[model samples]
Target chain A: MTSALSAEGLHTYYGKSHILHGVSLEVAEGRITALLGRNGAGKTTTLRSLMGLTQAREGKITIFGEDTTRWPTFRIAAHGVGYVPEGRRIFANLSVEENLKVPLERGGPWTIERIYKLFPRLAERKQNRGRQLSGGEQEMLSIARALLLNPRLLILDEPSQGLAPLIVREVFRIVQQMKAEGISVLLVEQNARMSLEIADDAYVLDDGAVVYSGTARELAADDARVRALAGASAEEWTLT
Target chain B: MMTQLLLFNVTNGLIIGAFYVLMALGLSLILNLSNVINFAHGGFLVIGGYIAYTITPYIGFWGALLLAPPLTAIIGLAVERVLIRPLYGRDPLYSLLLTFGLAFMIEDGTRFIWGPQGKPVTIPAFLAQPLSNDLFFITGYRLFMVVVVMIAVALLFLLLRYTRLGVRIRAGTLDLETVAALGINVGMLRSLNFAVGIFLAGLSGVLAAGQLGLEPTMGTGLLMPSFIAIIVGGIGSLPGTLIGGLLIGVASGVTAVFFPAASEAVIYVMMAVILLTRPRGLFGEEGMMS
Candidate 1:
C-alpha cells in the first residue's frame, strides 16, 4: 500500500537541543498507526515536525507525494494535515461553537453538525466558552475541530493523556471510525496496551529513533518482548 | 443658583463625556485586535487634527472631515507594517516601548512641521451659529460634534456585532492563533484592524480641533485621559470604554465648574480611587495584567 505520510531520517530541534535525532517512520493509507513511547521518547516532537510546528534540520517529509519539510504550519495544514497538539490547546475565551467555527475548513464533510453528531457533548455545550468545558469535553472538542478539516492524515499528539477511561475509549472508537472511513491517522500514545489493541500497525520510538516496527497483532502477541521494549510495568499489560 | 450651576455642569459633562467615549472606543478596538496598547494613538489624533487644519481652508469643513481620517489610517497602516509587524510574539513591553518612541517622534515631527505656537481652528460658518433658549444654550458646532460622534459610535457597534468581517474580527480578538489555523490571514486582519483604529483616532482628533486649539502637543494632553477611560472601562470591552470615557468627561466638566483650581487633577484622583477600590476598573476582567 502507498504510504499516505512518510518521514525519512527526520532531524528536529527545540532551540539548540536536538530532540529528534534521525527519526524515520511511515504511515500506511487508511490505517491506524500508533507511535508508542514512554515520557521523553520524542513522540510529540515527531508529530510537531510532521505538522511543521517545529523546523526539521534535515529530513524529507512527504504528505500524499508533496514534500512539506520546510512549509509553515498554516501551509502544511492547508495541504490536508490536521494536528491536535498534546495538551488540549482550545482557545479559552472562544465559545465551544466559536472554537469549532474558528478552524472550519472551506469545503469539507466535517461540518459543525457532523462534528456535533460525532461528539454530542460539544453540541450540547456549543455556546459555552472553552474555560467552562470539562477536560473530556475539551479533548472531544479538540478532536472534533481537527476532524472538521476532513484531513487526509490526522496527527494526534497524546490524545489520551489525562482523559478519563470512558473518554479515552470514545477517542479510540473515533480512531476506529476514521480507519473505516479510509482516513489515515498517526496516533502518539503512551498507553501501549489500548493503543496496540486499536492500531493496525505499531512503532516503538525510543531515544528519538524507531526501535521496533511490526503489525499490531504481532506486537501484542509477544507480550514479554513488547513490555521490555516499551518499558511498561507488568501491571499495565494485565490491566488491558 | 446651585440648581442652575448643576444644570450647566451636566450639559458640559455630556459634551466632554461623549468626546472621551469617542477617543476611548478607538483605543479599545486597537488594544483588543492587535494586543498592543499603541502609545502612539495620541500621535494619530494629533496628526489627524493637523490634517483637518491643513485641508479645512481649501476643501471646506465637510470635505476636511472626510479627508482627515483615511489619511491618518494610511499612516497607521504604514506604522503597523514597518514597526509593529516585525515584533509579534515578542514581549508586549517591546511594542509598548517602540510605540512610545514613535509617539515622541510624531509629536516632535509635528512641532517641527507646524511650529510650537498653537493654532485655533474656527468652526465653519455653517456650524458656528448657537441654538439658545432662556434656560439652556448650546453651540451649534459642539452639538454637531456630539451628533456626529453618536452616529459613528452606533455604526461601529453595528459593524462589530454584525457583518462577516466583523465576526472574524470578534473571533480573532478572542483568540488569534485559532483564527489563523482556520485559514484566515491573521496578519492581514490585524493590519486592517490597526487601520480602522487609527481612523477612529483621527476622526476624534478632527472633531476635537473644532473644540480646542490645534497644536503638536494636543494629542499628548488627550492620551492620559483616553487611557484612563480604557483602564476604567475594561481593556477590551467596547461599551465599558464608552462608559469610562463618559464618566471621566462628566467628572472633569463638573470639577472645572465647581473646583476650577483642581479641575486638571480630578481625573487622576478619580483614577486613583477607582484603582484602589477596583483595580481592574469598573468593567475590567479579573486577573488581566493590563
Candidate 2:
C-alpha cells in the first residue's frame, strides 16, 4: 500500500542554524505513526516543512504518492493534510461554530454535524467565543476544525501537551477512533508510552535525525531506550 | 436661536463624521487584515473623486458615483498585485515606504492629469436645495451623503457578518496562517481586502466631491482625521471605528459652536485622551496597539 505521507533527506533550517539534517520517514495508510523526540528534536519542524509552512530548504515531500515538495501550505491542506499546530492556534475572537466554518472544504464525511456528534462538548459551546472555552475544549475545537477539512492525513503536534491527564486520555481516544475510520495520523507527542499504546508504528527522533523505527510493541519492550530517547515520564501512561 | 445654531453645527459635524467613517472604515479593514497602513489610501480617494469629476459630464453625478469606486478598486487591485504583494511577510517598513512613495506619485499623477485646480462637482438640482428653513444647514446633498454612508456601513457590516468571503477575511485578520492552513488562498484574500479598502476611500471621494469639491490635496486634508477615527475607534474593531469617527465628528461640531478656532484641535484632543486613558482607543482589542 502507498504511504499516506513520506519525506526523504529533509533538510530544514532556521536562519543559519540547521534543524533537520537528512531526516526521512514514512506514515503508512490508515495507521498511527508517533514521532517521538525530546525538546528541539525537530518534530514540529518536520510537520511544518511537510505542510510547507516553514518552506524546507532541501527535501522531497510526497502526499499520497504525489510530489508536494514545492507546494504552499494551503495547497498542502487542499491535498487532504490537516495540521493542528503545537499551540492549537484557535481564532480566539471567533465562536465555536464560526471556527468550524472557517475551513473551505465541505465535500467530505466530516461535516460540522458529525464533528459536533464526535465532540458533544463542542456543540454545547457552539456559540461561545474560542477564548471563553477551557483548554480541553479549545483542543477539541482545534481538532474538530481540522476534521472539517476532511483530510486524509491529520498531523497533530503534541495534542496531549498542557492538558490534564484525563483530558489527554479523552483526546487520545479520539485519535484512536480516527485511525479506526481509516485516516492516517502523524502524531508528535511527549507522552511516549501513551502514544505507543495506540500507535501502529513509532520513530524516535534525536537532533533532527530518526534514531529508531519499529513496531510500537517493540519500542514499548525496550524501557531504557524509550526513556533515554523520549524523556516521557512513566506517570503519563499510568492513568490507563 | 442658540438651540438652532447648535443643531446646525451638530448636523455639520455628522456630515463630516460620516465622511471620516467612510474613509476610516476602509483604512481599518486593510489595516486589520494586511497589517499595512496604506498611505496611498488618500491617493485612491483623490483618484475616485477625479474619476467622478471626469465621468460626471457624460454619465451624470449618480452614475459617476456608482461607477467611480469600482474603477478605483480595479486600479487598487492592480496596484496590490504589482507593488504590494511582493512586500508581504517583509518588514512593514518596506510596505510603508512603498505606499508612502505611491501616495506622492498618485497625488502628482492626479494633479498632472486633472490639473492643479479645485473642480466643482455638480450635484442633482433637487439635492442642492435646503431640506427646510428650520434646518437650513441640512441640504439635500448633505442628507444624501449621510444616508449613503449609513447604507454602505450597514452593508459592510452585513457582508462581514454573513458572507463566506467576509468570514474568511475576518478570520484571516485574526489568524492568517491558520486561515491559509484551512486551504484559503491568503494572497487573493489580501488583494481583495486592499481593493475593498480602496473602494471605501473611492466612495468617500465621490461623496466628498459633491460637498467639498475635488482637488489634488482634498484627500490628504481628510487623511489625518480618518486615521484618528481608526485610532480612536480601536485598531482592530470595525464598530469601534464607526463610533470613533462619529464621536470626533460631533466633538468637532460642538467645539465649533463655542470656540470656532479649535474645531480641528478638538479631535486630536479626544484622540489623546482616549489614548491616555484606554490606549486601545474606544474599541481597540487588548494588545493590538504597541
- Predicted model with the maximum DockQ: 2
Docking class of 2: medium
Candidate 2 has an fnat equal to: 0.62
Please report, as a residue range, the 10-residue window in candidate 1 chain A with the lowest summed lDDT: A231-240
CA error at residue A32 for candidate 1, angstroms: 2.6
Candidate 2 lDDT by residue in tens digits, B1-290: 99998999999999899988999999989888888888899999999999999999999999999999999999999999999999888888998899999999999999899899889999999999999988888999999999999999999888887677787888888899999998888998899988888999999999999999989988888889999999999999999989989989999999999999999999999999999999988878832211
Tell me how each candidate scores on DockQ against the true complex.
0.30, 0.57
In candidate 2, which residue pairs clash?
B234-B284
Q: Please identify model 1 stretches exceeding 4 Å from their true place.
A: A225-240, B54-60, B63-67, B111-127, B134-137, B154-175, B286-290
Tell me how far the alpha carbon of residue B108 in candidate 2 is from the true structure, in angstroms, after superposition: 1.3
TM-score, first chain, each model: 0.94, 0.97
Query: In DockQ, how does model 2 score against the reference complex?
Result: 0.57
Q: After superposition, how far is residue B192 of candidate 2 from its true place, in Å?
A: 1.2
Clash pairs, model 1 backbone: none
